[model samples]
Target: MAKPLVKRAIRGATVNTGSRRFNLPEREADGDWLDAQGEIDGAPAPLRTSVTVETPRTIITRNSSPDVFFDRSINPYRGCEHGCIYCFARPTHAYHDLSPGLDFESRLFAKPQAAELLRAELRKPGYVVAPIALGTNTDPYQPIERDWRITRAIIEVLAETRHPLTITTKSDRVTRDIDLLSAMAAEGLAGVAMSITSLDPTIAATIEPRAPHPERRLRAVRMLADAGIPVYVSIAPVIPSITDHELEHLVERAAEAGAKSCFFIPVRLPHEVAPLFRAWLDAHFPDRAGKVMAIIQSLRGGRDNDPDFFTRMQGAGPWAELMRTRFRIACRKHGLGNRGAPLRTDLFRPPAGPQGELF
Candidate 1:
């Protein structure tokens, strides 16, 4: 029999772990490596993040989901390093034959050609302009973006083409692009949604390990608002028995940070996320893990998740109703009702061809 992979904690990571398959002991039809590891190991070194370039021929992804706000989106990267255990997008990595656990965090992919491809797509003769949603799948501004600059490059392309854009991210690093964003906002071409799940540092750290601190996110919200850019605060994945309690307080904070509005989603455990979340709760909040999951199940129509369109975003059942009610009340009290003005698509123009720079 093989040993179960050890559960360990990595700083800035929810669960310093890998998926079942990735963690499997190296089977050599022999036990030499396992014995050798035991002899020399005190504790294994922490996993390091690696980035790979993904060259995709296209950049914009179109969708027809009635529930989502936008029809077109761009994901500059695959596999987020933020390692939020509750992330609904975790299962995406499985498509690449990568683990949805720690491997999803440490093994990352960047689309350096994103900006160029976006330009090409925009130049297509029949291209129709709509607000391009950024960071819809994996965060566009994940850590590796500092060196890769794919997100910024994509933004530059959007800004140059006069395309309307909506960005959602938790990293304060978005502030680094304020110059471009502010320029677009002035033209009614850009808006941003900053996701801040919890105000408590400890909770935030554990849930979104590599994400920017809550305070930093708040500051970024303020910065965007001050720049005359529309910014909304997202209290996403409101986990029962954990982050759910912070709801009203978070709404108040968002209002104080100058957010135009606020919205939240009850945690959704779609696909592989349910097991990962269950393991996370067991490891971090063992005492109430059962209670947490019970409430979640009740909200999820007696299952780990409710995939039904409208219900999936806000959840269902009494618990779900209560959460929505609380959110509405809080928003009303804090006067955060604005959803920001509609973005203008009229300003869009195709990228000025390959030598767009020579102008």
Candidate 2:
């Protein structure tokens, strides 16, 4: 029998069969899936339900934009296993003819050449070393990192080159790199930010699915601090009505756990993510979905999302101000404020190589 079509929520794509959802075979397949019309379907049609990991050639990606803080970053993996429903990176999977929902989580990619590519880039002369951010777009320390060790390899390259770097992740697996991170910290070359969405594990499981428990992330903060690395707690994509109540407590706990600073951003639902997030909210938190969206709209200037630069990271309007006020009060109460030292960029050493060379 021909394989059944998988039911998913990708835009404009649907599985009309009411009786069953598609199931993968016991093993993975290498080729793409074709629809009834013989055209390539954007949703992933995995032959097996189990995880498939693949590697790409290049790693270091350079971006010149006004909105983001860092100009360069490296993502060792393509699709994250953490399976956060609100992941903005989900839309990226559509480029590979895959769904931004479940497929984005199960169908994974890693760059085994990441360390080599990073070394090649760093070796280029005149490459002004700035803090290269990891886990900027996707969580580098996601579950697969344990097996692939791609992230660890990338960090090893950075450490050897004395390249200043910053990492943001929600997993305690970051602790595994503590020795390297600690050594770099001594030279003002590294920093880490742990994303803590909610203090409640139940909410975390439903929203983030595969991420580590909240308390484990807090413990990671302590571990990194104990290792002498600067650690910050990021309570990002702060979903109103749901996780908003934990703002004060979250910051308080992170500070208690040795987090040097705390930051947060209101939830963002751009492009295909808006619908995916809505479906998830409806499925898991039906009672609070309406209220949550309303508060999000309030912060977003009456829209589902605001793409404007400064306002995008930090929302606009009264609700945004209220969130800022709460965060400020909490930080002040916990003694985490401007007095905390800023990440050092002065120690950046140009990656050694031929001037203006592009790999």
Candidate 3:
């Protein structure tokens, strides 16, 4: 008989460290263990993140989800390192036979050829121009972007073609591309939305471990708006008992920082995310765990998630209605949610070449 796999938990990591659930033959760890150095430990070791590069045949992903604003989006990377406990994207890691827990954040994949693939797709005869969205699944400006520069390269291609584009991210690193985006915005071809969940640094750190601080995101909004780029604030996945209280404050502050528009979504715990969020609540807000879940279920139709179209983004029930009311009132007072110039797809020019240029 084969020996069962042993899994050890890593401290200070958002996801619980353990073997992936997808692994087969049903593995279990033995309680008995031996220390290599005979029981000499101060603090638990931290989990190390590893990245793999993939050369995908295609870059643009087509989505027909009515809830999403865009028809197509590009994800330059997979498995975000930001490690937000409530991230809806975590479950995607399961497709790789990796645990949606720690592995979702620690084990990452980058598409180094994203720019090349995008250019090719854009040059195709049947290609149509629309605002291509970045950071839909994984943040294009995550920490590793500094090294890979893949997202920047992709933007360069769009700039060359004068294509309309939208970027959503939690990192201020998007500021680095201001030179490119600002020029595109000049022609009504670019816009950006920065996601900020909480104004409290302590709470921000606990939830979104590696994302830019809320203040930094606000600063980026100011920088982008000052540069002529349309900047919007996304106060997304507002946890009922935790971050929801800051709804009015977040939108008002973002408007003060030059965010012309704002939108928010109630927290949704789909599949594996439910347990992960529950674990986080137990560790951080044990006192309110039951209450929080109870409120969330009320919004999700007595379930952890409501995946229906239109209704999924926002939920039902009085609590959801109350949150929406607060957001609307705040937006009205702050002069936000005023959708201005639309991104222009008419300016796009197909690249001329047999092989797509790598920008």
TM-score of each: 0.92, 0.83, 0.91
> Residues 268-357, candidate 3, lDDT per residue (tens digit)?
887778877887887778999999999999999999999898878999999999999999999999988666677899999998676444
Candidate 2, residues 204-275: lDDT per residue as tens digits?
877786789998999999999999999999899799988889999998998899998988999998766777
Predicted structure with the largest lDDT when compared to the true one: 1
Winning candidate number (TM-score):
1
Name model 1 segments beyond 4 Å from true. 1-5, 11-40, 355-359
Compose the digit string of candidate 1's lDDT tens values, residues 190-226.
9999999999999998888889899999999999999
Ranking by TM-score: 1, 3, 2
Between the candidate structures 2 and 3, which one is better when assessed by TM-score? 3
Worst 10 residues of 1 by lDDT: 21-30
For all candidates, the clash counts are 0, 3, 0
- The collision pairs in model 1 are none
RMSD in Å for model 3: 3.8
